[model samples]
Target: MTLYETIFTRRSVRQYDQVQLEASVLAEIRQAIDNEKQLPGQNARFEIVNADRLKGVAAPHAILAYSAGTDAALANIGYTLQGVDLHLQNSGYGSLWMGMGKPIEQSADYRILLAFGKTSAPLRAGQGDFKRKSATEISNEDNAIARVARLAPSAVNFQPWKLDFSPGKVVVRPDGGGIRKLLTGNLQKIDLGIILKCVELALEREGKAVTALTPKGGGKTFAVEVAFE
Candidate 1:
């Protein structure tokens, strides 16, 4: 399956049978993880754990845990993790971003988990039918990329970023209010990067080309512009 198809078809799977990932598939995943760790601006690392190792942990059937040392690192980890997830889905495997606090001993200061396995059953009715907010709902201006960004996953599905579009520039800010408090700091920003990557992937699939500029400012509250050549 193509990466675009995987993006559209992938969904969170929580159950699995007694099955082991094929050696080739496991190798591909390991290679991808290695490449992601080498990517600049992120200190993310991943490990594949056997079912026995996950017995008492809050992890999924087979777990791949990604970790970093800081909030900034965590954000980068999220982006890289999603990219790997999309790639895995395209390769005919299913994956879900497992939530944190699943009971695990960790030396790293920051961490996230993803569970992988074949879908126990076919896609049920409305399995991939989740809806995203309209452009106007998420941003006032027309941001094709930000629209895709809105589809990025978050901890418990809590999307907590707001975009302000200016000519050749898109400003991003935290929308931490009531329930949004659940998503804060690096997790929120990292999730934003993941969504941005998805938007970029989707746009590329449609044959539209865009150049993403570095986020403006130094910290929190930045901008990413999608410039069409």
Candidate 2:
């Protein structure tokens, strides 16, 4: 399946085969990460290392992400790695976002970890296999982009975002209204970036050429404006 298609079926895989992948396959993943485009101007660093360098995760391999601790920098890391997460799962590997996992010799730049390795764990059969908020709960418009984008995973499955669709653009804002404001701190910014990737993919699938991804505001007022043709 394509990365966009994988979004519906992707799962946070924990169980792994414990066997390491071949050198060639590991090299391919590393190159892919090296090539993935970040959010316009943001620069985040990623290191693919064996499980020996990691703590807390049991997967045989992992991607250690490092970046400045600012909101845009953290979100940029999330937006970037979430695509890697989908691609790994689509290629029949298991991946999980591990906030607690870190490089054993950690530096201040380390932001988050993505644990991935060979696994027998399965992907969901389809959209119904996912447990997420209803269309009415997370979006202002009941459309394809919002439907698939809402499927993007969040920290603690909080799904703390609001999708507002207008012609040629989609505004993804931190959903701080009502009782659905579960996302907080640095993780929430990252979660917003995660969903933005899904929104971009959905737009591209619809033949919309995304012209820009402009992040607006900061802290509680954080939001991303995805402009497209």
Candidate 3:
């Protein structure tokens, strides 16, 4: 499947076959990581490690994502590694965003993990297979961008973002307050990055590019404002 098609079919696979990944497949994954550009202005790192290096994850392979403890680091990793996640799924491997998994190599920089390998789980047949928020709920208008962004996976599936459209801009913001806010404070930022990737992909398919991404000064809640030219 194409990467774009994989976005519609991908599922978070937790159970994996108990076998090591072939060297050829592992090399392709590594190449995908190496070729991928990091999120602009973020210093995130990616590495493939044995499942033994991660705690509580049963997948035979794990991609340990590391980043400096900067404000945008976690979200950047989410945005960057998600490409590899989709690529793996397109290549017939299973992948899961390991937000809660612990790494054996203790480092302050280790931000998140993606457990991936052969699996028994099935990819969805199409976008209709996803249990996602409607486009109208996630954005100002139910356009193509909002429709795809609605499929972005988030922490606890909270879908904690709202897209507002202007003349030449698309503003993404955290949605909700109280316990939900506290529950997904940092994770929602990462969630925003995931949604941004979906927006980028959707726009790219229509021959548009993000002209700029500026961090709006409202602390961590409203992470970024994206302009498309």
In candidate 3 the C-alpha lDDT for residue 37 amounts to: 62
- Cα displacement (Å) at residue 218, model 3: 5.2
Candidate 1 lowest-lDDT run of ten: 55-64
For model 1, the superposed segments whose C-alpha errors exceed 4 Å read 35-40, 55-71, 101-103, 123-128, 183-186, 206-228
The residue pairs in collision within model 3 are none
Instruction: Report the lDDT of model 3 for residue 189.
Output: 71
The TM-scores of all predictions, comma-separated, are 0.77, 0.95, 0.93
Off by over 4 Å in 2: 176-184
For model 3 the TM-score comes to 0.93
* Per-residue alpha-carbon lDDT of candidate 1 for residues 20-96, written as tens digits (9 for 90 to 100): 77777778788876765322455566777655655333223444445554444555666678877877666766677
Ranking by TM-score: 2, 3, 1
Of 1 and 2, the candidate ranking higher by lDDT = 2
Report the lDDT tens digits of candidate 3 across residue range 148-179. 87898888888888999877788887785678
Instruction: Give the best candidate by TM-score.
Output: 2
Residue-level lDDT of model 2, residues 139-204, one tens digit each, is 989888888898998877888789988888888987744444433456777888899999999989
Lowest summed lDDT window (length 10), candidate 2: 176-185
